[model samples]
Structure formats: structure tokens, C-alpha cells
Target: MNETQSILLASACFALAFILASLLEYWLHRLMHVSKKVGARHLEHHRNNTGQGVLWEFRDYIRGAIVLIAAMFFYSWVAGIGWLLGSLAYAAFSAYAHQLQHENPTKCFWMKMPVHYVHHKYGMWHHNFGLAVDWWDKVFGTYKLVDWLTEEELSQPEKNLLQLRWW
Candidate 1:
């Protein structure tokens, strides 16, 4: 392939990897809800309403996908690098979003409603499984809009957007 074609292919791979990561996240979260063993672990998060820190979360994501990332390199070096960057970017963003929602759901500005926050706060077992974004939830017909911020949240002291566990 020409240099231009290689670049375009890499770019396409990046975008595809980014989107695939989100879709995978949505499905994995849903799996956790349905699988008893997984749900047992996930229940701890619901009970605590806390995140395991951004870096740790990202590490977990990378750890889980390491083999897939390696397989991407076999396709092509450019594609592999692009996919790696895109997947890492999404993992980082999702980790940050997860932690932010746990610390202060109001700080999540990208979404009109932070789905994960409501999922946990409302004990929704069958809805709002998307962790990074709500696109998949909407696509799968699992998205539900509820009054997220109650009087309790409204009355609580405001928190700084960056005041989250980042370790």
C-alpha cells in the first residue's frame, strides 16, 4: 500500500478500535450482571459506589485485552499501533469517567445523564449497563432516564470536578 493508503488504513483502525472498545465495555458490563460469579464481584462496586482508581482500572482493562492487542500487531504494524493507541485512549477515558461518576456524577458533562451513576444509585439490574458511554444502551433498548439527582444529591456540598481518586 502507498503511504497515504497506509495512513488512512491506520486511521480507520484507530476509529474502529475506539468504537469496538466501547461496544465491548457495554457487553462485558452486561455480562457481569447476568453471570452469577461476575455479579458477585460487581456487587461490591454497587455496594460501595466507589471506583478502584483510574490507573488500576486502566491496568485491568489492558490486562484483560493484552492478547487481543498483540493479535492486532500480527495484522500490520501500523494497524496495531493505531489500534493500541485507540484502545488505550478509550480505556483511559472510560476509567476516568467511571471514577468521576463514582466521586461526583454531576461532573460527567459529556452525557446528559450519567448512566453508570443511575445504574448503581437506582440498583438497576437490567438497564444502564454502559460504563463509558450510553450509545450501546440506547442501541440495545436498555437505556432508561430517571430522576438521577435526588434531594440528597442536590443538598450535598459541591465537589471539585478533579477531586477524584486518580491513583
Candidate 2:
């Protein structure tokens, strides 16, 4: 229960929780666009007419606040402020990445932005599946190119990945 031990323990626990949450996020992303119809709830997100954007998904924002508070409370009880900070940071980063990834060209890894945009447009369910970073997608082998970004489109490197977006 020394200071160093507490810090190490907290860091480990925080990393474990973050990895689990990130993995879960990948699956959740896949589910949202699983079908072309967009399911009942996600359909709202797909509507170009409503002028809704992913960042304004109010349902998720409200739910996220509650979950974040609860997670912080639980982490604080078990491992003190360090763990709470780690978990909160992880949660906030994940949510921010999800929103930013889909939002306009705000501050983000520019290289991945177009790739993800293609995924969104073409429904590349398997590719660009990771949020917060594409590290997971690259690790998991689920990364696929937008169908149009085939051998030809990639060679040019300026055709908007063609029109297939995601394969």
C-alpha cells in the first residue's frame, strides 16, 4: 500500500479497463451500421434530411455523463484519485474520438480522417472500426478499404477513394 505500489496498481487497472472499453466500442460501432436499413435508433443518425450529425447525438451524451460519473465513483473507491483520473481520461478520450472522427475536419489525425470518411460513406463495416485510434482496427485485421479504394483508387491517391467508400 505504498505510494509507488498504489500508483502502479492504479495504472494497470486503468489500462485494463480502457482496453476492455475500447474493444467494446469497436463492436458497438460495427453494430450501428450492421444493416443498410440502419435499425430503429441508428436510422436517425443516417438521415441526411434531419440535419443531424454524430456529435449531436443527445441520447448518448446524457447516458455517457451518468456512466462516466459512476465509473469515476467506482474507481475512486477502489484505487483513489489516480484510478479515477485514468478512467475518466479514457472515457472522455474515447467519446471525443468517436465524435471527432465523424465530425468535420477538426483537430484529428488527418491521415485517418479520409479513410474513415470513406468507411462511413461506403459502409466498410469491417475497416476503420476503431475509435480513439485506428490502432485496434489495424491490430485486429478487421481493417478493410472502402470498396472503391481498390488497387486503382489507391494508386492515384487523390480520387476520393473513388465512390465505394467502404466495402
Best by lDDT: 1
1-167 in candidate 2: lDDT tens per residue? 78788778777767766676566666766677676553457556445412133434333533644465356546555454544555556566655555544443234544444444456666665677665656667777877644433453335423221122121
**Candidate 2, 167: how far from true, in Å?**
32
Extract clashing residue pairs from model 2. Answer: 122-166, 127-144, 146-165
Clashing pairs in 1: none
**Number of clashing residue pairs in every model?**
0, 3
Candidate 1 residue-wise lDDT, 116-159, digit = tens? 99998889999999887999999999999998978867886798
RMSD of 2: 7.5
Model 1, position 90: C-alpha lDDT score: 92
Runs of candidate 1 with Cα error greater than 4 angstroms are none
Assess candidate 2 and give its TM-score to the true structure: 0.60
lDDT against true structure, model 2: 0.53
